[model samples]
Target: MASKKKKAPPPSPQSLGLPTGGVETHAHLDMEPLDAEVGAVLDRAVAAGVSRVGQVFLGPAAYKDGKAKFADRDDVFFILGIHPHDAESANGVNLDAIAQAFHADPLIKALGEIGLDFFRDWSPFEAQRIAFREQLSLARELDVPVVIHSRDAAEETLRTLDDMGFADRPVLWHCFGGDANLANEIVARGWLVSIPGTVTFPKNEAMRRAVAAMPLGAMVLETDCPFLTPIPYRGKTNEPAYLAFTAAEVAHIRDIEPAEVWHATARNAAGFFGLTLPSHT
Candidate 1:
């Protein structure tokens, strides 16, 4: 019988040696493996050069349960929204609860990771559409940026955003993995594209090319941690600290210094989240 091989430990973000200033615009720190040691994880991120992070809560309960964890973590902002996977549960009561959560928590920067997920189709297409529109209305009402999660439904997603009047709005296309053409379309609509760790994969040449083609000002970096760990860290559990790898990969694609991409994306994320980037020591 063949022996099972152990996975290699990921390189520390500190080893990458990029300047501190990177902002991880998306992450699920409240989730398992990460939630257990969220404090240590954030400390590692600080050492890794990531100056700030966005913690996404999938629902109101998640928001209520996890908000206390980051209470003292000034660098960690909050994003609460319903995922398409849970679209069917987006009833009026739940939407109201989401709204109330936003009203109660000024730190909740945006409404998102909410859009269609045709790839999974975990919920009915109709249910996803209704939930998406309802949440978009809430976002518009709350006047916060919207973070999108479109999978195998980009065209439809764009169509919906257009129909619902999100043009030139503070919208972020999260986990973008398209080519330059789609990237251009997104930029033309005046929305920001968030580049995820997948950009470091050799198999995602299109994503690399997209990074090259996108204007630095219109792009941001994200770990989407607990998922999409970059390159050398590909098989390990991802954390905000690993955003340096994604930034370095983006820098390589754009033929610029990693620090440049790091800072520029930080600004983009700051603008999207409606917060100012603090001066780091």
Candidate 2:
């Protein structure tokens, strides 16, 4: 008998109907040796329809090739800030320098990935608080939105914002992992909740519920790439192109078509970052 030919495995259902003009809101393209050669990386991203990527530029050590990587590229905009871990390192001169940079660079759209991470406690609570508040002040001073990262310190983080009145800017709880109640409160306050690949894991029930119940306008999509790879690509190094995976998963959870999720999320990112999204092909 002739041997039967092997059948090709079906493509991931999650990969279907990917929208063009997709934007990745929280890609850390400035993270280390990877930052070097990000031009080729971004070239690939553009070819894949990810035309815009918001890069969060960190310290001199992190951006050592003299002025953060991709600084001149128009396709890559940035949110300038000192991360919470760098709290102590952000001394007087450095703080003034970054503020001056932001004043000069209009492309620096937001202040972010800047908040508390009690999980790591890389910086002391007091120092993190001071740095966080100062950046929030700078963001508000500049009329730009702020991106926040909270870990086990959510309550304190929120409280600090409340006290500092830093909650006024268009704040996004990036890669939000808070519970439903907290999510609801955040949405109620008109803040955006960004969902990353963690929402796709079977065990991440709370996150799934949060996304399912979140209002369409209050949601934004992100890959948090080089981390949080979605379903089929989970555990792999992610890229901006993989945002389609996340948008599809969010659509599935919300029982809507992927395009619906794509448009709304794109609109949210554009509105939040003040980016003008290019038309999809």
Candidate 3:
């Protein structure tokens, strides 16, 4: 009989050599079904050196729940907006609700995860465009940064932002999947791009190349948790604790130490959200 294959040990903060107080800039903690375990998840994230997390809201329900759940935690921040896939549901009333939440919460740092998602087409293109524009307008009026989610609609998204005269607004392209040229354009526009756990996949050479070409100042790291689980645990449910793996891979791609990627991305995330970094000590 063949011998059983040996299982690899799970990753730990020490094993990854993660820098202290790195930020997991984008996660959907409210979307996870295990509500009771959310605290444990965040605790694991902290133990893994991810001291801060940006919880993103895709709709009104998530916004309400997230606001109540993390309202008092200084370690957690928020980005609230209707996702492009839910654009059809983003009527004036709902948009107002989102704006109200933004205005009501000082911890709500940006308005987003909003942009084009032609790949899913869960919502009509026209509705997506209208919602995108309206939220962009809201961001401008509120004088807050925007977090963008462009999937298979990069050109259209860029064109829309440019036409709306928001080309210079503070923008974070979350889970960026664009090529080097697009990355260059994003950085040139003074927008930041977040690298997700997908970078750890061996076949994702395009993403790797994009990360390699990204300037350190323009880069931030995220898990986009409950999705995009990094390698060595690809099919497992993702949490912020897995961010160190993504950071390690990014460091490898950039030919630098993981600590450099962690600190630079942490600083970039802080500047983008206008939040002060907590001392790791």
Q: Report how far off residue 279 is in candidate 1 (Å).
A: 3.2
Task: List, residue by residue over 75-137, the lDDT tens digit for candidate 1.
Answer: 889989999999988888888999998888889999988999999868999999999999999
Clashes per candidate, residues 3 or more apart or on different chains: 0, 0, 0
> Which model, 1 or 3, shows the larger lDDT?
1
- Score candidate 2 by TM-score against the native: 0.88
Highest lDDT: which candidate?
1
Off by over 4 Å in 1: 1-10
lDDT of 2 by residue, 153-233 (tens): 888888877887755458999888877888987887678998887887889998888888879899988878778877777
The lDDT values for all models are 0.90, 0.77, 0.86
lDDT of 3 by residue, 1-281 (tens): 99999987776755786757799999988875534577888888888888789999888778886567775567889888999999988888988888888777788899988999989868999999999999999999999999999999998988888887777679999998767888988888889999999998888787788889879999999999889888877898888999999889899998999888898899899988987776652
Which ranking of candidates, highest TM-score first?
Answer: 3, 1, 2
Of models 2 and 3, which has the larger TM-score? 3
Q: Clash pairs of candidate 3?
A: none
TM-scores, all models, native as reference: 0.95, 0.88, 0.95
